[model samples]
Target: MHGVRIETDRLILRPTAADDFDAWAECMADPEVNRFLGGPQPRAVAWRNFMTMAGCWSLQGFGMFSVIERSTGRWVGRLGPWHPEGWPGDEIGWGLMRDTWGKGYASEGAAATMDWAFDTLGWTQVIHSINPENHASIGVARKLGSTLLGPGKLPAPFEDDVVDLWGQTREQWFARRRR
Candidate 1:
């Protein structure tokens, strides 16, 4: 398999697998976790979404990673670079299982994903689409050194929803790292 794996000091960001279903379903099924991510979805819906992500890797060469805690060896969430057709931009996004909140995993995974996107994937820029009410994600974006770029909207199913595009260029990211 040509799956990609990125290791951080505390977590591993890798491609999704069939074995990841239960944990993925668990997280996706949580109302709190999905509050700003389009609301809680049924297991069947979660299965289709999970399969879509897996297919994205096979077709796009890059997509959301199944975030794993190094210590627990359990799935914590999914965070990484994504650029599906009709997306506002190349984005590095995240959604953790409610239990995984407040541990800084989002920032850790996002930083790694930004590094991989800018350096490995040769992407020059990355954005994060944050709902105005999603203060947590806004904080994470700030911690990652991304500033609010402007307003943006997601494609169908979420076309009516609004988002603040937060991001930095590859150069900006490197400069922040040098600090």
Candidate 2:
């Protein structure tokens, strides 16, 4: 599981580093950014969350990557696949700083990761779980051609919300990509 870097038209998706603390923390601290995911977290908590995400790559063979802009090289957010505790299968997740919202970076980066999950990793299925009220993420799921797999939940490390699960199987992915 060597480090993987994915490039898009306007963004770079790469492994996160210690230097990303400030930017990542800022995003996690933004109320708008964290609203659907248990709200803004304290700095210390956010750092721990980032570290957990970083550690997942080593432990799980696949995990989210920090989303950076190509021109400014600024951290915009994170997008990739993860194996969340108790999830039935691989989960695809994405988050962007409040300031970077509405730019389609989430969808773009997520689509890239979906490609890798299916084409590179040979995964048969990938899930995207979000709170039902999170319209932004719902839109991203649609953009990536994922289908609603109905409701599901994983034990909360923070709160008690039942996350809505969306999914894309390898057959669906290949079908969508062909269009």
TM-scores of the candidates are 0.98, 0.94
Q: Report residue 145 deviation for candidate 1 (angstroms).
A: 0.2
Mark the regions of model 2 whose C-alpha exceeds 4 Å error after superposition: none
Clashing pairs in 2: none
Q: Candidate 2 on 102-164: residue-level lDDT in tens? A: 888988899898888887778899998888888889999998898789887676563377677
After TM-score superposition, what is the CA distance of residue 77 in candidate 1 from its true location, in Å? Answer: 0.5
Candidate 1 C-alpha lDDT tens digits along 112-155: 98999898889999999999899999999999999999999889
For each candidate in the order shown, give its overall lDDT on alpha carbons. Answer: 0.93, 0.86
Which residue pairs show backbone clashes in model 1? none
